[model samples]
Target: MKKRTMRWASAGLVLSLFLASLSFVPSGSGNASAATSKSMAALYAQIQNERAAKVVALVNKERAAAGLKPLTVHTNLSKMAKDKAIDMFKNKYFSHTSPLYGSPFDMMDAYNITYRYAGENIAKGQKSAEEVVEDWMNSPGHKANMMNANYNLIGVGYYNGYWVQEFIGK
Candidate 1:
């Protein structure tokens, strides 16, 4: 029984060593692979930007129907919203407040965004920008943020299945 146990241990050690060594192996494509990865990353960023823009447009349409002025997209606020979405997706939590980043206002402060009035809306599992915006508009709290005349700046972020919208006004 002891000998059998020893053999099993030896086999486990060998397997571990083999797996560890695999990490050191070169992929052969090297710089070409890295360049491709960079290009793919840029393409993905562009797609995400487009999706975010679509969300803004849809939100603006909703506001227009309600006779509210369209909110301009704030770049810093967008960065903050994107960071929140990424944080929520990575940490697997969906809420206006994040364990890592605190509330939306906190995130805005971190991004150096100043506003006298601000609001945030978050959603998950929506397949498209329209769907997510519709979901938000259906919710009273989110709809208020969307239609609030006090808000003059907007930021949107979509990552994976998570969506975040930040609203701000002077």
Candidate 2:
């Protein structure tokens, strides 16, 4: 009971810090909204501009470097993203699911970004999953802040040559 309480307390503290960080955005200012839109547009453009064939080749090259089997590059961006997410989870590298598993919208909200289905609005062309991921990782604002603050807990305890998720086992 005490351990559970401590865990909940820590979670609440982290959440409070996360919310407080948002207060840096001026009240009733449109810049926050506009900045988000611009970031999303950049992401959309990056995804659209990336060639699926080139992305596939890049992924295959990366796999060879990692000594893993190459994935078949498909011209389907959505499918590629899904497969990459699964593969990353399998590798225990990084996981969107690990942070928040409820829904995509919720996850996007936590990350403070807009997410749209490929056919919904801006993203129409198919890009390789790896390319899309690279774009997101390279994004300036939300991605950086999230890594620095909210998700840092998951990253800690893994440093200093220790397995943080030891309870889950290797």
Best by TM-score: 1
Full-model lDDT, candidate 1: 0.91
Residue 25, model 1: Cα distance from true site in angstroms: 16
Residue lDDT tens for model 1, 92-162: 99998899888888878878899999999999999999899989888998899999999999999888888
Worst 10 residues of 1 by lDDT: 22-31
- Candidate 2, 1-170: lDDT as tens digits: 99999999999999999998875777677678678989988885454334433444543454456555544322233333343344344554553333433333343344443323211101112244343435533655422322221121111011111111100000
Local accuracy by lDDT, each model: 0.91, 0.37
Return the TM-score for each candidate structure: 0.81, 0.26
- RMSD to native for every prediction? 4.4, 18.8
How big is the positional error of residue 135 in model 1, measured in Å on the Cα after superposition? Answer: 0.8
Model 1 bad stretches (over 4 Å)? 1-30
Each candidate structure's count of clashing pairs: 0, 0
Regions of candidate 2 where Cα sits further than 4 Å from its true position: 27-29, 50-170
